[model samples]
Target: MPIRRRLGYLPALVLIFFLCVLLYAFQLHSLISTSRSIDGIEQTADQLDNYKDEPPNKAQLKLQNSPLENEADTADKALLESPVQDWVKFVRLSDDIFLYSVILDLRDGNMDYPCVRIVAIVRRRQSITCNFAGNSSVAASFYELSENHGLSYGAFVLSCKIPQQIKPETVTSFIVQQDETKTYVNVQYTVTEKVPPSMPLTYGICIPVLYGSRYGAANLVEFMELNRIIGAGHVFIYLQHDRLSAEMIKVVNYYKAKRMLTTLEFKLPVSEQIIWYYGQLLAIQDCLYRNMGFAKYLAFQDLDELFVPYSSENIVSMLNPLFSANSSLASLRIPTRYIKASEEELAHPPLAMKLTMAAEAEDVLFTKCVVRPEMVFEQGIHHTSRVIQHHYQTVALPSSFGQLHHYKNYPSSVSNERVPKTYGKKFLARYEQVISELQVKS
Candidate 1:
């Protein structure tokens, strides 16, 4: 009887085991279906994210394809495609040639013959070719500046006329080709119209390259203060970076921070071989073009020189009458009086007051000028080389009205006379105030 009962329980146990297996199988099938549903939802979300809407309306399309927008896109594309170059750095073409900048010449009267002028330091004999946009190439006309001082390398203005089919404003970059060499040089400076109808600055001064470590903080401070007192609103100084002293750099940075001065790094590809400041002519010409249509009046002088007004308080006060009197006057040639200052006097705070004795005005070796920049084409160290012909004239300023005081070391044989005392008191007062402000800032 016991054996039969044990056999009957085995069949029931087998039935329970089969039921459990069926329940587990059903749960696994439900989980697989849920996972497939989630994957399908994710696929739908991805399709919605990437779905494209209808095309834009006609008005929107017109705006997107406007002429101005197309032109801007063209310019942007050209710039992106061109090789990168620093605007202010010189681009070397040959062993003996270096190009500084290229400017679009669109002076009011000369729009018919629009051209681009390249300021360069190059050998006179080498021929240059200008390759413009659209693959058009032309020979460049070379006009050497007269103030090269017989150096092997000299300042030159290379000009090329714009093609009739091409618009002047659209030509942004060009390549230079030398006749003797096969290498083509890409001009670092982009051709653009820098001139505007009017500018905020009344007076601007351009100082040639300050090379060697001779000039220090004191020299810069005195120069800046005197110019400020005389109504110079802006000043540009070309600095030889490697040769400048750390103290001078600090002073330059200070004035730059005040927005009173702009210092450009000036270096020649052949600095070791060039004569004393041969690159200054290129620098001044660059400055002249840079100041055009900006400064009402621009003066060219060195750090040791100051233009003093005798009858008026500032340069503008003296210049207004001259401009009003002669409508055709483009520049004023100021007479210079060289004053000898001892080392002790130069080391003092106020250089103008301490160095009162000056050489006669007749002994001036070279005179400097204050010019209307738009009227002048090229500038030399002492005078303008070319002006807008027939429309402008350069006049000699009388000594009684004003003079440039050039502080330098002179021979003992030169006669020394006391400088005019007309503006001495005013200059001293302004100098003291400037010095105090500088001290406070430091």
Candidate 2:
């Protein structure tokens, strides 16, 4: 499809043209313009006095670099070239100023091949037209490789082809959202300095969650896994039930036994009104106190789900320092898709749901990752009839690859508890059959 040409496009083009004119104007005048511009009548007396850098505050300078990261002067091409310490600017295709994010090495300036990491978020300003689900701001991130060409700008990373899946629509709202913490990252001195400390990069699995299954082992690793299991971490389960079910009670014990469950209820009550702090929330708190370890991050998902890796880098992340600004929850929205269920899939328990994208409900799935455990509402926040209450609004998802698989939608299910029967039965049976059909190498 051709680019949607609009009146807005003109301004952007014209702005670029005008900015070029300004560049020449600044360079042409040069030092002559700098002198009088600082005076009260021209530049203002305050501007003249303030132009000078204040004496360096040694105490404030102490926490300047992190030990884990290489020294500022290490000469890492990636670190030196990335946007950081005032050398970066974000621009949109339309010439509008878009505030995304850029991180540069803040170490000694004498290094080469500085390790650079630039995560770019692209967004078109146009509003959604059709198939719009409440006009969520579609957005995507691009890893950038930029080179400063002697006052001329040279972009090496942006030119490389980005895979189709990773490209996102221009966000309607905002991203890498502004936060005090993101605004300022500490660039501590070299690791040898013992004044402050630095931490290694830690990650959280983004769970495509569902509520209770009333069955399944409590230990998350016992049933399904990807490579390995954790001793304890946040598991965001989507409890679709308005209240705790008798079957779910048994399920709750599963997590309770592993010391890993936090039951969250997001309802308003049409009939038997259960207050917060009842089942799910109670379980979460119980695990925290009993296990002697609190959940670092809880994925609100169902029992049938399991996370898979989508990127070359085992972990795909959308985390920005700005995530802290929102409430204790981060939204996890999966671009809905589906998987076909076979006859064997339907063979077991009647009404068994499937995890394919087709196994979804009328409502959209914009799950919020549980951050602060204490903040887990017992009754969950408020919701209409069949949805997770939206106490913490959603922030646009950070990636195209950051998604999980859902096994059982109610209509297609052979059994709810036996969910994701695909993995348990279908997949297993299929594997055995394939193996049997294959000729032995011997």
Candidate 3:
């Protein structure tokens, strides 16, 4: 029983201790990584705020500058023969004339109207006539279809606007043939995007809000409130009565507010009584009834968020197939919190926000933000969809409007000379109903 005998197990004990530590560290790291991912969605800077647009490097892709023509150009024919490899885009500077400008999508909103590179393409004339069944005489108008170079199959000018309910198998358009003979391009396209059972609800908007707009950077609520007044829809239509905030509202001029509203397809018929929250609810009902099969961007942003669908021209094109597969569900926005201040205004280096176990050590993660229609709902007030995201395709909408204009997002504006206490008071006025409702029982 000497001291040496007791020390015999020391080596085994040390190995066991090391193994335990390794396992513990691995588990801890995993937990910490998962925790951070749940809260943070944005990955980095340098991303366009277009959260749902497709991903393509404009450099590598072969972009169509004008419509591809099967026939040779007599005048601009010489310009059409350039063997360009980049994703080139061109516009007809002149209608009948052949002045073309080559454009590139720099992929940033700040870069207005990209630098236009002039290119040459000959414009040819093909005499063609179009015939389609129409009560109001078949009209003809010219539209440049391809941005590539020439007409793939002659200029497919639309004769007349087709009715929404009717589907015409063939559309007739008059084309000018090099031949003085009368000919027409039988433009045919199946009616895509079935009107979605009259989604009385056309507009869509969502925000991750609870009691307040604390989640966003600042002033997010103000934007939501403004969106409420402007009413959500395409540029033409404006809805009233239906509120997008789930937060209970007092008996005020407005009804209940929610993060989202869809009255486009409500079981209830559209009536003046429920004006406040009708259209938004209908949109939701329409999506559920007829638009469930509609895989395209089923949702859109409230007025402020610019949503451009895939311009690939293919009818059934997917935005980013790698991320938006038919995995248990659908489209997602890989949200990124892009700082708005210019490089000169940047007070700190651009770093993606991440949660850390130790105050110093930070780790990046993949935050899954799968946003869908069913996942979108009105829990009580503000409108929002459960977000889904991926690295390459999704974008965080950078806003000077301060995260949809929330009061909490005011810190950035604090330093601005333009902001005064009165402005803040007016914003709070928008939410007066919600404040009163949440005040107390006594």
Candidate 2 Cα lDDT to native:
0.30
> How close to the true structure is residue 369 of candidate 1, measured as C-alpha lDDT?
90
- Each prediction's whole-model lDDT (CA): 0.69, 0.30, 0.28
Local accuracy of candidate 1 as per-residue lDDT tens digits, 217-303: 767887886677677777888776667666665677666544567777777777645643648888888778776666678999988
Q: 216-298 in candidate 3: lDDT tens per residue?
A: 21222333443333333211112222442333222211221121322220122223232233223222222222222222234
TM-scores for every predicted model: 0.72, 0.28, 0.23
Residue pairs with colliding backbones in model 1 are none
The candidate with the higher TM-score, 1 or 3, is 1
User: For all the candidates, what are their Cα RMSDs to the real structure?
Assistant: 15.2, 30.3, 25.6
Please give the TM-score that candidate 1 achieves against the real structure: 0.72
Which regions of candidate 2 are displaced past 4 Å?
A: 1-223, 227-278, 281-293, 307-363, 366-394, 410-442
- In terms of TM-score, the best-performing candidate is 1
Task: Please give the lDDT score for candidate 3.
Answer: 0.28
**Residue 342 alpha-carbon offset, candidate 1, angstroms:** 2.9
